[model samples]
Target: MVVIEQEPEEPTRPSSPAAEEQAAAAAGGEAVRPSSSAAPEEAAAAAASGEASRAAEEEEEAFEDALTDEQLREKARSQANDAKAEGNKLFGAGQYEEALSQYEMALQIAAELESSEDIRAACHSNRAVCFLKLGKHDETIKECTKALELNPTYLKALLRRAEAHEKLEHYDEAIADMKKAIEVDPSNQQATRSLFRLEPLAAEKREKMKEEMIAKLKDLGNSVLGRFGMSVDNFKAVKDPNTGSYSVQFQK
Candidate 1:
């Protein structure tokens, strides 16, 4: 027999050494190691991604913290402006009541805002105009007074108050207010013209009453038959039929 001696049986490898190790590692829940050459880059990539995620989180937190109280106030002011715009639209359309409500709400909001005096003055003036249009003279006067208090030199408020006084037949008060307005702004032609127009009517009416009173006083003081002035018997009166005029003959 040729080379009858059998070579020693080759050593048998375990059927699945790597599979068993993976199963053991899986059971133990330990991370598997990557190949040594690629491991550093993979780890660096993971670290970079983790760092980026953390940075993004921190940025979001910082942005949230930056929303300040002034921003909130500005937001409120913007909303008030929106309300005022709506009111202006309605006022343009001649919807006085609706516009008044919008303006009032806007004014309330504006009052809470800082440095809103101008807007408040405008609101008060607008409300007064609406009230005047509605024939609410007292309310109009009240609003105008408030506007004047807010801004002492507000010409519109002064003019409107004078007009309200005029409407109430308080002529002297109206004249005084108009005078003050004109003093403040000499170029105000309306005030000047109003004074010119009203002053004459007032004077004329007073003069007419005074003339009537004087005539009554003369009649009461002098008797019709006073001897020095005249006697009915001594005075002769004649009526002319030829002319429409009556002729009176008197002896001196």
Candidate 2:
């Protein structure tokens, strides 16, 4: 079992468009201009061409107005670290929804600031765990997938995704993932034990299904004997592969 650390709650709401502009301004950049109030089709066409140059120019002006790229990147990293810390706090308090929000913020900042694979993997895995707590199996799977794609050797991502797959009744996929995780981290007792449990259950299920099929075939053969007014001992049974059925022949 992956020991997921809880994240903290988000300290504030998401930054609005206005806030994003303000942040840019504070950094010496201008805010992005709003699109014109024309019909969407017309606006899209305009935005597609030079007509949208005005917005681009406004954004450029903001960029020129802000601090250096290095400074902006440092600021983004700092903000992201703050969000990550908050997420950890929320997770500790069992506020999964709030924790997930903060993790998302941290991930967005990481993407923009550092392109740091490690931080991105952590945030994705954290969000996946939060989704698991919220009982959102599909979303958990998605987030875990993202984390794994970022770092294939990420043990927590593999284990958590396997759990989510089990919740979805995709047992084979779950087993496959767990096996990979075990290969990566042989010291993980939880992964090893989970594999142990799944292997036996899978074998047992197959055995049970085989037994059921055999019992069904026996009943059908007996019914055919009764219809022929003969006991099973009085006849020999042969299967016709073409029709997939047994034919009884009178004994010599």
Candidate 3:
């Protein structure tokens, strides 16, 4: 008889770690190890990202701390001064539209400031001049009104509103504003001249209104007198210009 040796066969179902290990070893493989560089690279990336975030926050805080309220106001005033200077130059050159732009820029800066009321008033007054040049009477009046509200003694604003009122046929309002302007500055020759000029116009308007009232009253009187065979034309009131008195007469 010949002697023969046979190899052991694999188990149909694994029962333990030894069996699994043997199985893996039989398949010519081993357990994996942690990566050598991946963990370090990941950690370095996280640290860099955190540092960048912190740096951004610090930069924002520094920026905020750099400018206090007073400092910002000072900066705004300085810029407004420059804009006003530029606007003055443009206005002197008769470039009204361009001057208006510079004045508007000054106003924008002035609005952001805390202590530039005079500057704001000046900007509005200058804009009123621009609107006047542009033939925008209503806009001029509105701008001057804003300026006057800021500085009630603004002579320019008073004069401009008076002029606008005159143009719009508001004679009484024009005279009132002119009187105020004169009252505010007694030595203002322009206001005095304007007042003198407006007085005659106001007088004429008043006389015309009186005449219109008399005419309407006469018409109503005539309607009533028609029932009695008489008319308002039969009655007359004559004024004595010297004494400023009137005398009534009736026709026979």
Return the TM-score for each candidate structure: 0.55, 0.56, 0.60
User: What lDDT tens digits, residue by residue, belong to model 2 across residues 1-252?
Assistant: 124576944444337986765556645745445556678998788657655677788788888767577787888888888998899899999999999999999998899765678888889999999999999999999999999999998999999999988887667788898999989988899898888877776666666776697667667767887886765566566778998566667774
Q: State residue 120's C-alpha deviation in candidate 3, in Å.
A: 1.4
In model 1, the runs with Cα more than 4 Å from the true position are 1-67, 201-252
**Stretches of model 2 off by over 4 angstroms after superposition:** 1-67, 205-252
Clashing pairs in 1: none
Pick by lDDT: 1 or 2, better one: 2
Candidate 1 root-mean-square deviation in Å: 18.9
What is the C-alpha lDDT profile of model 3 across 4-57, one tens digit per residue?
A: 566855645558987776666656755434336567889999789888888998
On lDDT, the candidate that comes out on top is 3
Local distance difference test, candidate 3: 0.87
**Residue 99 lDDT (model 2):** 96
lDDT score at residue 48, model 1, on the 0-100 scale: 94
Q: After superposition, how far is residue 91 of candidate 3 from its true place, in Å?
A: 1.8
